[model samples]
Target: MTRQILLLSVMSLWALCGATHVKADHYRLEFPGMDNVLPIASRPANASRIFYAVMFDAGSTGTRIHVYTFIQKQQGELPILDNEMFQSVKPGLSAFADTPEMGGDTVRQLLKVAKRTVPRLEWKRTPVVLRATAGLRLLPEQKAQALLEQVREVFDESPFFVPNNSVSIMDGTNEGILAWVTVNFLTGHLYSDSKNTVGILDLGGGSTQITFLPRSKKTIEAAPADHVAKFDMFNTTYELYTHSYLGNGLKAARLAALGALGAEGLEWQVFSSSCLPRKFREDWSFGGVTYKISGVVDGYTGFKPCYEEMLKVVQGIVHQPQELKGSSVFYAFSYYFDRAVDAGLIDGTQGGMVEVRDFRKRAKEVCNKMSKLRTVSPFLCMDMTYITCLLKEGFGFKESTVLQLTKKVNNVETSWALGATFDHLRNLNIH
Candidate 1:
């Protein structure tokens, strides 16, 4: 039996730099740290070869580090992955886009966590890498490149093995693909047939991704050329329906819904919407820009109009795959999980299954009772409504569609970072 170990109560996301020497049954993993937390088991023949890897996820909203430890029981066999040590810092690297050096400083600070976790002797052999997501993608090319260059300089100065192209912006397609891989791997579904794999829905701050293996040929034929992606992992070829919509993430959608996405003259403009509390007013910041936002003070507020407002962001904009209307397994994470927890729709610690209509029902309740629910986020009404519209209108899922909201599987976070690490290891041929 294959024992898959996933760490819970740790950090979330990717690593920084190079490759490793271990290969698992279907994938390769090399992350270092958290070994001390788990008792070291003595081994015979191979002496239990251990390897380490550090991955940094430079997301639009925050920067996070994941240090993973893998133990190889025998040569050429799958390494037993242990727990991961995760850490994070907020306001994301994009916030420091104009000040590239400051952005680099954040990475430097995160390296401290890696340094303290991985043993000193293993530093030189451990690979470190950083992959920026939608946040950096939205920045001007010059600014984004500048920030990436600064991070490269930081990686060079560190003690770990930094590979070529160690710090760069990750394309949206790969983001979705990797996330799908992470979830399926954690669920022990990687070695099974494609139909057994679960789809993934990732709502980041700057983008949202939807990826799944389509069982119907119509889905592949009807989708846009770019929406279909094919990659090789674990010696198997996977052709998946995947796409990451930039500017469709939770925070990005909030701006788009307010008609403030690219509007200028933020100093005087107060973008208002019926989705917020009637008296709510504040400044919101995203991707290095800030905007003044408020609720319609004397105007109408509630689910009816809010759903219509959010529908504009989804309807006609998000492509509805033909097969999604049928029964399919999907795991939603990131902001999708966060908002559901905030609305009492699901437990934060223990995720649960919910129907597509559940979001709609909750949106109606939350939007209609915003005043009494003042303790929750003022934007709850808007978010819940938007999610409802995105699913039923944008994605074309049936109201009865079941969605599994989760952050972790077993003990490990279901994130793209793990899959990306496996991809990195395969590229290096570290063995």
Candidate 2:
């Protein structure tokens, strides 16, 4: 009886030891937000085993994938391991529709390259997060749904199998908010700082978003009962106002320009480069010099007409109706046109000017003309009441404040790219 008891005790001890070994090797992976891919991996040979988590930002014009490693000492904060970025011409929606697996295939190609470079990574345990941005959101609802379903199907076939809980599609509003937040955080314009509230204008390739945040004041008093309340502003707090205008990017600019010119029975010669539109390529002569216009047709209804139209749009969106009446309008298109000339695509002195001048000189001439028209136009003084209402509704700002924030630009990038806003949001932890 004693020998039998000893044998049983020995078996029980071995079982417990094996269990401990298995538990010690276990690890967990996490991904935040639905729009990104998270990749996780383990390094077995190192003295202190390391695990990595990666996220991919799949945008319409480019793809950015950032890898991060879990730091146990830092309470699992994932630090960047490797960041990769690639830009491609916008792909057609039909392409993704026909091959749902293409999205996964593209991801796999990227991962394959990453893994090959980092040979120590354990492929079996890696978890990847994939998120699509403007490209997916621009699609019609049925098309977007189909595209997502295809992405899921392909992602499942990857070497690193995704658990059922590992994937999601971010809602459009959330994506817009997060993108707005990210830009705000990076530009030092987040409302968390008790300085003057900053207004943000973001012009993307397909859409534009305008946001406003209330300035934080440092002179506070009582502690809130809820911890979250410290950051929360009650109804008394200044709120963020945002306006997202759809179909207003470069492509839209071209379409609107074409529509306007078509009504007038005029057509500008098209340029070979996809970036340059037909109307902008028309040959023009001034002061005995002929010049070829480059860059996308900047605004609808031609230069002067479009400028007036935009002013009305801006006036309507501002808080004070009269503030913009005589304000200086800054032209943003000059830079874009200057770049095109620098690239040697167009000649500015073809009409036989005595001296050949750079693109800047030509752009300056164009801007001067537009500015003169804005100053002299009789129709420029119309009431901006409608625009003011839009500004109030879109950005949640008082009508007066909206008027104060109104500014004009000749180009979209200089006026309202979302990069700055994205930065601000990151700092505020909205991303």
Candidate 3:
């Protein structure tokens, strides 16, 4: 059996996802102080065997549980994932800010799935964790804390092993890196002998993230200090460029483009835009707040007007990568996959890849369609236009950039949750 050593990396993301370290087959997590927690079980007289972990993602749109089952191939080596039982509940934990107990109940409900997935005898040995993202981070400090406290209580009542700082909000920066790790890991980029790794573009409801190992020295030298990060992994140190833009996701970007973000009163001013149906008017909810938004009742609307409005939301906000335009591969998921599916650009179950110009071409079609009549999504025009501008004007990508649109790779979810869980097992050194 080949031996592997999992060591501590950089500590910047610890504020978001906490920190973990391992030595001599013993795990030590500092930020959460997970000392004396569930150690690798030696019950069967073999330190190498099966193990289970439960991860809950309390995201802006929903709360999801990934009950991961793994088999330790050998001592001091990475565990092989046997299976993952995934399930989710809607409205997100942030929606229950005013009713925290209900938020706790949602967690308790998901724990039932964990209870069934993980064998009863292994219950006491399995560790369960929950990490909230942009949703809770957007809430008032008090409300977010209340919701977290509620989840902690729920975790305590469960039979599974719960660690210190079991529930908390994740940093936007870490979110990007984790997503990058997940895609690269699933695609075998981490295991191959190639010097390249695929980039990741995640568009969530409240935030969007971009991460990639920069091939250009200029990308690292000329970029903002905060955007460049270095971490140790795979027995080597890696320097990457990553960042998460808050309030720039598909949903939040709508509020921003509509001029409703941080607005004083919801009903005082009804935000009207050219991206909506001419007679469309409705109230939308996001991050626990509601707003009255509509489209112009009588005026011109189409790709031209919509693109102009969407441009304001991302014209100068996004920082372009120094070298992605030439010969780089990227995987764009979440809202990217969904919107492409909605626009008939790709299928939901079998997500197909698309070039950067493809999004532009589709955005024009969707926007022009909206200008004439209603399409499948009322927000289709705005969403597509935002993605288009966000990639081109915002991120400085050329229309030729190729982005592989996918929800899963190798039958595993290509989400940050997978990378987040890999943290617990230690990012394995690929043989």
Error of 3 at 3 (Å): 21
Q: After superposition, how far is residue 338 of candidate 3 from its true place, in Å?
A: 0.6
RMSD of each: 5.9, 17.0, 6.0
Ranked by lDDT from best down, the candidates are 1, 3, 2
| TM-score pick, better of 2 and 3 | 3
Computed on alpha carbons, the lDDT of every model, listed in order, comes to 0.82, 0.34, 0.78
Query: Total clashing residue pairs per candidate?
Result: 26, 48, 1
Model 2: how far residue 213 lies from native, Å: 2.6
Per-candidate TM equals 0.88, 0.46, 0.88
**Candidate 1 — which residues are off by over 4 angstroms?**
1-45, 192-195, 373-376, 428-431
Better of 1 and 3 by TM-score: 1
Q: Where is model 3 more than 4 Å wrong at Cα? A: 1-37, 40-42, 46-48, 74-78, 192-194, 371-375, 427-431
lDDT of 3 by residue, 232-291 (tens): 554456688999898898888999989998888776779999989887887888887889
